[model samples]
Target: MVEKDGIVRVGLDAGMNALVRPAMYDAWHDIVNLQRIDAPADGQFDVVGPICESSDLFGKRRRLPRDTAPGDVMLLADTGAYGHAMASRYNLRELPPEDVIDGPVA
Candidate 1:
C-alpha cells in the first residue's frame, strides 16, 4: 500500500488472473470490506492488484472503510461469468474453483 498526493493505492492479492473485467472492459465492481461493513468510509483508494502491468487496477478512487488494512476480507460484486471466463494461470497463479450461489444465504 502506498499513498501519495492524497491518492491511496491499495494492492490486493488477486489480479487479472482472478478478475479481468476491470482490466479488460474497464468495468465497475463495487468494492466493500466485510470486516468494516458497519464502519463509515474512511477514504478513497486506487485498488490495484499484484500484477506488474499497469492494467491490473481493480478500481480507482474507491471509497472504503476507515483503517482498512492487510488481511481484510474485501468483495468485488457481480463478477459473474465474464470474470470466470477471463481467468487464467498467469504467473503461476491458482484459479480458485467457482462457488456459485444462486440466492442469498440463510
Candidate 2:
C-alpha cells in the first residue's frame, strides 16, 4: 500500500489471490487511522466499494477507525495479490491503471 496526495492505493494480483471468496467467507482487513490516532488500535471493518453491487468489496470485517468517512481513503493491505487483476469491465467500467512504485519489483 502507498499514499500520495492524500489518496491511498492498493494493488492486487488475480492469478494468485482470492478476491470474491474472501468476502464470501467473511474475511476482513484493518484500516489504520494514521492522521488522528498516534497509535491506532486494531478493529474490524466492512470493507466495500462505492459501486453498486453485492460483491464489490475488499473485505467484510475490516478493522478501521470508528470515524471513517466516504472522503477518507483506505488502503486494503496485501491486496497486491488480487485487487487489480480481478477487476472486470462490467457495465462498461474501465479497469484501473497501474504504476511502477519505487521503480518496479525485481
Tens digits of per-residue lDDT for model 1, 40-75 = 997789998888798999999999975888899788
Alpha-carbon lDDT, every model: 0.86, 0.46
The regions of model 1 sitting more than 4 angstroms off are: 101-106
Q: In candidate 2, which residue ranges exceed 4 Å CA deviation?
A: 1-39, 42-44, 99-106
Each prediction's TM-score versus the true structure: 0.87, 0.50
In angstroms, the error of model 1 at 85 is 1.4
The TM-score between candidate 2 and the true structure equals 0.50
Task: Evaluate residue 94 in candidate 1 and report its C-alpha lDDT on the 0 to 100 scale.
Answer: 91
Candidate 1 TM-score versus the reference: 0.87
Model 2 over residues 67-94: C-alpha lDDT tens digits?
A: 5544553444444545566646655555
Give residue 4's lDDT in candidate 1 (0 to 100): 78
